[model samples]
Target: MTERMSAEEFRAIRHEPKPSKYRNRKTVVDGIKFDSKREAQFYASLKQLERAGQVYEVELQKPYALTVNGQLVCTYRCDFAFYDAIQKRNRVVDIKGVATKDFNIKRKLMLAVYGIDVEVIR
Candidate 1:
């Protein structure tokens, strides 16, 4: 039985894309690419805070090496690190849409090694 698919059906099937690597879609703003729309929104908020003088500085994608006993375990890259004038201290922020085992392990290692609490904005 040879049944021909309609043009509309063929077009729809052709246009259907595979699932993306990440759960969220990547977004670009001001020539900078963000992992997700949520991250981009957060970046906008941070810029607003800096302009409002709430935050002194905003640094993104800061990498910290998680090492143990003179051995490098893994590098934990935080989403945002900044000097918070309101809090009167530096803060590390990592907004997790989905917390994976790797992130959990690295987060624990970060605290155990550096004594820095990563602020997770889920």
Candidate 2:
């Protein structure tokens, strides 16, 4: 025999946000959920820049596929992408507190294969 919980209790237990493997707590802002507080702050700043017309456009979670020798190796997802109206250049940003070996490998593959330089914000 087991005791049944109410809907709110179930939701509280089931839908609670948990810390990531690196202990980065998730944050929600403007109805958009972000992986970390730093990411969320960056997003807020981007929104401000957009409003100020410094950024022409803003994109979130942009993915780049890395293929080697005609075979797909992996996909690296960027935190944010935007066009700088002042600099007149496109920017791909990754807000990283820690860089893993997998990320380092993916970064090399990205540059070697696509010539895309990822901008890292620590």
Candidate 3:
């Protein structure tokens, strides 16, 4: 025979604070935790593009290191990346809720270091 747990015990075992509705709501889709619903929507669109053969591959949360003189300075994580066969190039995408000074710096560094332009989506 198995011991039954009480409701208070269950609640205590699974307690987690609810996220504030006023802030950007994080969503989990296909077992991936997106920063916001908008981002998840964009990811879904990417999936469609992949299915349609518009993009060769879709990468989520791609990380790039910004190096100066072969030393790591900072790291930039883009929201999405895809290879466009027609364009014959890789495109990096960033879904930004708010563009901060730090982000701008990293964007510029990415361009200087990697020579890849990030497409910002507001």
For model 2, residues 18-106, the per-residue Cα lDDT tens digits are: 65788887899999999999999999999999999999779899898888998999998989989999989999888999998988888
Residue range with the least summed lDDT across 10 consecutive positions in model 1: 17-26
| Error in Å for residue 54 of model 2 | 0.8
Angstrom error of the Cα, residue 30, model 3: value is 1.1
List all candidate RMSDs to the true structure: 3.2, 4.5, 6.5
What digit string (tens of lDDT, one per residue) describes model 3 on residues 65-84? Answer: 89999899999999999998
In model 3, the clashing pairs are none
Query: Relative to the true structure, how large is the alpha-carbon lDDT of every model?
Result: 0.90, 0.90, 0.89
Q: State every prediction's TM-score relative to the real structure.
A: 0.84, 0.81, 0.80
Model 2 root mean square deviation, Cα atoms: 4.5
Among all candidates shown, the one with the greatest lDDT? 1
lDDT of 3: 0.89
Model 1 over residues 7-48: C-alpha lDDT tens digits?
999999999987666678788877889988999899999999
Give the clash count for each candidate. 0, 0, 0
